[model samples]
Target: MAFFIRWLKAASFLETKTLILDASSYIGGHLFARLGTERAVATYYRNPVGNVVYFDALSMSLSEVVKKTQDITHAVILIGDTKPDSCASDIRKSHALNVESIISIIKFLKERHIKPVFTSTESVFDGIKGSYVETDEVNPILLYGRQKLEIERYLQDYTVDFTILRLSKVYGVSPGDGTIFTSWLEQIQRNETILCSYDQVYSPIYVEDVVDGIIKAIDTGAGGIFHLSGNKPYKRIEMLEMLLSIASEFILQPVNVVRCSINDFGLLEKRPLNVSMVNDKIVKAMGLVPSDARELCSGMIKKFYTNGAMEYR
Candidate 1:
């Protein structure tokens, strides 16, 4: 019995030792930022007991990424979702710049023989319908959605092993600009009125839940497309109201909230009226249960304000 117990302990040790992460993209940057300095460690394969190594893609080349890929038993690619283009020519032109960045990374990882775990957006589905499943056909109207769909096809065609996580709208505070949460936090902090779309519906995943889902997927070796999203669907206006209510409860001043039609925004592409995704596959496969949006938002607000992230906005 003692020998059996020792063997089990050794196996447990080995399991923890084999995982390594190659976080070279923006999503990687944000994920590690949340995981923080304490959990950071060296190569998982070499150390046999370490956590994750945060590799910055900007500083490293494709060769370096390949070297790390060969060294680790498991790796993850964290890329950000593409942003929407506005009707204005200048805005559309500026947003178009991201397409090259997205394509380049995909090409780089492919060349390195590193099968990446791709992160996509629910915007890929035209908001005309809701309750999209894994088998549903994707029809993206927004430029960002189209780009992601293109990449998804590219990866599916070329890569031998890959898992696509089509994420719902994400909410959380980060250090720099970008993210709807950051924008909303800034607007609320300044007591500025924020315009939200009433017609558009989306399910929001808390940043922590996103990270957890990713880790779960990685650990389980589950491949193919999965939707990492919130279980509940809420309209843009409803989300704003919930945010305001949470802020007020936390002693933060309420900001004026305005509802606007999607057409008035002069968006370049049509947005799907519904962007909610079903989470049963991820939940059943990965055993991941996402937190309620309200609770998640409340936690994020507290973390931002108490941790001085609010000051940055």
Candidate 2:
């Protein structure tokens, strides 16, 4: 009995040792600014046994993952996906920096007996579909979605010990700029007209909520697939309206918003109309509740105000 107990303790210790690699750390890059140092440390990662290392996925190859690193219980790969209306250069970056590199990283992690936690996107589905689940069919419309779906398929193979998080449209205050929310804030601050789609709909998960879900998945040792998203879906215009309401409390600016349809854009890729995913599986397993986007965005605005003012990148 004593020997069995000791073995269990050793197993538990091994599980706690993790190497969290934020390949695409921009989503929460400057979260430290808003969350402060100590709180950010506790929120971003908590390891009782092992050390944590943050490196850009593009900077290192799979060979470096094994050669450069020592012991780790698991490795989390949060990389990939190009921005909306990504150009040729952006697509190339997604392939070279994320898609290709992650394949090798997964193989390396598997060989070393380390769990691989990957972040996927809701873009895997064509926007016509809403309330997608883990078992739903994947039909990517954009290049970004297709690449992410390709990774998802690779990880689904029998040999990989992995956790795939299919995330919704992640919305939060980017410490830098260029995010949809930040861009809207920019136009609002300048009192300029903002044009957005009325037909488009998506689950807008706050960046902090995304971080929270990632931690929960790691702690629960979640394998296979899960959806991390907000409690509901909102049209692009609706979200912008909510943001306007929130901004009213902090800023005194009347901004003009012009609502258009998805057809307004004449781009190479046809954007998905509605690709919001349901969070039944993630919520049930992780014991997490879907957050209200409005409340979360309000919190983001408050955080920005507390830090003097929102700075453009």
**Best lDDT goes to which candidate?**
2
Per-candidate TM-scores read: 0.73, 0.79
Q: Provide the lowest-lDDT 10-residue window in model 2.
A: 42-51
> In lDDT terms, how accurate is model 1?
0.64
| Residue 217 in model 1: lDDT | 67
lDDT of each: 0.64, 0.68
- Clash totals for all models, in order? 2, 0
- 19-121: candidate 1 lDDT, tens digit per residue: 1243334445445555443432222212222245444333444454344423223345443334575413344443343344445655665554434567788
RMSD of 2: 5.8
Query: Candidate 1 at 272: error in angstroms?
Result: 2.0
Q: What is the lDDT of residue 112 in candidate 2?
A: 63
